[model samples]
Target: MTRKVDYLFLRKGSQNWHLKLQYPGDLGQKIGRKRIEKSLGTPDRAQAEILALPYIQEHKMHLLHGHKDFRIVWKHRFEPGRQHVGPAGERIIATDRELIYLDPQGVITKRAPNGDHFIPVPPLLEQKAAVRREQLRRRGVRNSDDSIIDTYLKHANVTGYNEREARAVWSLYKELTNGKPLREATREDGRKIVQYFEDNGLKSATIQKKVGWLNAAINLAIGETKLSFNPFSAIVPKRTDSERRLPLSEADMKLVRAGMEQLDRRDQLLLRFLATTGARLSEAFEIESELMERGCRYVIIGRKTPQSHRRVPLPAAVLPFLPRQIDGQQFQGTARSASKRLNRFLDDIGITDPRKVIHSLRHRAQDRLRAAGCPIDYRWALLGHEEKTVAEGYGLGFPVPALKRWIDKIGF
Candidate 1:
């Protein structure tokens, strides 16, 4: 079977996917419909999931407003173009461009300017839906755990949803419930889910994060109803597992420098770049060499933090490793490989704790700042960290010259 994403569902026999959504309010009474489902063509489960999401959304609009215009838009949206697999797994290519339409009497039409024909959707195609306003505004009081998840994800669709986090939540929820009604779900169910994660050898802190997201989702879905309780209310994910890798000792730093010498010129400079400037491995790998300059005191970090995109002063150790200017990226190869190479060197130098990875250099840089009497606020700002204090967010919290001195102290 194919992977399901929200409203997208895969057909067991046909191997095709569909979207299913619940219609809202008394609007269903007017249309003899309480739900909507649409076939998202393709035996390829991945593409169907992609196409179904937007279709479910449009279908939701039709369900809510029940307008002929919306129906018309939905009907012709999937123009029979290009190629798709036939019902029996045969290769079916569009002979010509054709559009599917739905007439008022629930008839489906396939219109081609070349040859005119209208075909109704087969009974098997009647399968999927996507709910609109996954926003808690409408789905809040809905009873299902799925409703809570839907609402939370819909909200995240705007700000941003961490893909890893979303996957973790679904993996746990999928194993825990068969769309159990959220209001009926209890604290015990939540605890059971956490235990499931632990049984699978997941870390306590990671499971805690997943629980946190579920807790937030349940809170969002608790509208004006008889139920005022959240199932995930009692999930405690302590921060004991947090990674706070300290700076490498001065002796260890020298060992790392020596290890860099063992690498080729490109990787040598790249590791040095990360070590001294605290740039991410990917950032060092993506530097458009044209951006670098000779004798420049400061350089802008990559786009990972746009708000903190101000120039940061470079330490002297990193300066010797620079080339006058090249075309792009100091290093070659994938970021993963680069990290593996760095780790191998760490292992060689007798430093191989799971927590003390390549990023510990960045931590050490911060320690360098503190040892040099740099303020905590300035230390983070220099590292292009999201300034923790509101004061940092307000304005140019620290002037360039002052910040320059702190970064200058981050030397080998």
Candidate 2:
């Protein structure tokens, strides 16, 4: 068990919540107090819970990052919507119902005295919200869980995580928080979260991922609400040794192709595409069919990294059958859903190595590209990987025809 920081506490004398903060190092008292105590002001546990979150977050920021201003954290806890600096200098947005944040004249808007926007509240939107609220009520999803989950979900698209997956992480936190707001999440609450994972016999890596997701949510919430303290950051998850995912060999590739001979067309196409292009399953789905059909010149593989996602040349054989464009994402279901079936096929093919899943096909593609005399420069381009060194950064990578030749050699 790790030694804890008790940042938020319920006073035994007053029964009201109080903030107790101390920076880790014995640094300047000017940055923050040596020991600070402030009344959180509500006898009600629920209200106290909401009030404590940002102060706790602020204290942690001060302790770890030398954040000097505690007043900002104080405001965030009590007021979600307040005047603050914007790109255009000063701007104010209400707690909710804020988007298209400027009028034609480009002036900021203010919320009600309670920090909530009341006007322009559409009845249809209200009705939908009421229905959802009732649904949550019936389902027993606590109030404290909803906004925290929403915060994470809203940021998921920007952060490149599935909203459903991020919600699942906070759902666990919400269960732990009950109906209390995420603001009230104390050091003990964090300990309980870690304990829940450990008690359930989860692996350290799994627990770390879960906790990491929560920390991200907290950070996003803090950034928007202007709170700095994050108890989740304080909880260091234990690291575990993990298996290395080595690529499949040429012989192994032959076995995989042979195994795929019996798979469904969708699965077959998906695997073959991954193997040939050396694209991630994600980018494999998003290949621009129009670019692919244009003389098989280049297929757009949407990668997170800009340079890696450049137009990759398509193998000739796939051009005839490939669609011109996928509407949005390439796959309908999640990668996990596809992987469950893909993994089964991988196992059937005698590639029982856990690390060698559909992803390893790309590695095999790299291997085949190398075996076919493709230069390292062309290989990295096809694989959607960044150049390893500054020396390799001389020019734009190999042309389409050169990349095509190497990828062509490995075609099914």
Candidate 3:
């Protein structure tokens, strides 16, 4: 006698077992089929039952998730028959009887002719099936352990300090969200991030900047990811007044000037140049001596900002202090090291305020220009401040000679 197996049927002439399963009424319309069938491609019933488990699980998940294409190999097959209801309220008119059915708890059970049934899955196999179900359910869903920050950085081609800052902020975001995928990050997570910064004593402006970077990055990647909108977009902390660099007093200025001669020639020249012209420390370091040797009275300040990209006129007082000729970059070390050295010099000269660093000299230059009765346009142009009014943006700005006239009023 041939043994009967759940979810497996043998045709009249063939000894090979075939798999068949009936879809519940609701799922049949969605999958566009009332039943699913496929060849197990084996003569042995044991091998066929083993192969049938995947199909059975796939059908269960497909019905559970309402996915139409859970298993590609099993195609839909419908056969004509008169409708009849079985004892358990299952349709009995299908071409093949479904011996396997999902119980109330969703466990697969084998149904016998005498109304007896038992779950076919052992505990170990059931655990693995649960994992497989999760994998199938999450297909095409992003956030399943993928690094969204790395993907965004790769696509955006972010590099340098910007890349480093974004990565740093992203790391913090992960920590705040308990290392959740950035795509899975929610508005609540953004709130938590802001709260974290505030609790750590970060100023509102700094918190805003860090959050803004994260917001802008996610905004750029919204089109590629499944996220509807950036969670950090409206979560920015309120803006607050930023710290200002204190301008040097006349006595402070005089002290710096008198102390310049006590330093090395390079230090004296760097200090005098910044004090007179109000050029940024980085911009000053970028001034190639070769460009000045060609008799260019102005130095280009391109690396800072579009407004700072203007040519700053060399003040007449500092002209005697400039190197006549040198190869490559004018300053030896990086701009950061140069600022540290200049700040130390200020501290040594008794101008020791936290805000009275090397950058304060730039503020002093504007004050000096204002004292000399330089017009507002000339002051804005000389200090590389962005044009505020429509009229200010109209011209090529004050001529180099015109800028030199006002800048000359300030002495080292």
Give each model's whole-structure lDDT.
0.63, 0.65, 0.71
The TM-scores, one per candidate, come to 0.50, 0.55, 0.55
Off by over 4 Å in 2: 1-145, 155-161, 191-210, 234-240, 292-294, 303-308, 320-332, 371-373, 386-398, 409-412
Error of 3 at 251 (Å): 1.0
Position 216, candidate 1: lDDT: 71
Residue 353 lDDT in candidate 1: 75
Ranking by TM-score: 2, 3, 1
lDDT of 2: 0.65
* Candidate 2 lDDT, 198-281, residue by residue in tens: 898776676777777778877887888845667688685556655557788767778886787778877777776777777787
* Model 1 lDDT-worst window of ten: 127-136
Assess the local accuracy of residue 203 in candidate 1 as a C-alpha lDDT between 0 and 100: 78
Compute the lDDT of residue 21 as modeled in candidate 3: 93
Measured by lDDT, the strongest candidate is 3
**Could you give candidate 3's per-residue lDDT for residues 1-412 as a string of tens digits?**
8666677988778888888899878889877899978788899988888889977886776665654322222221323244444468554333332334344564645543322222334478766877666644443243443455667677777666557667667666665676666556688888888898888988788888778777866776777665666778888656664667898988998898788866787877788888898888878877774333234477766455556666677888877866665345666677777888889888888998877889998888888888889898777787776544555456567667777788898777
State residue 68's C-alpha deviation in candidate 2, in Å: 55
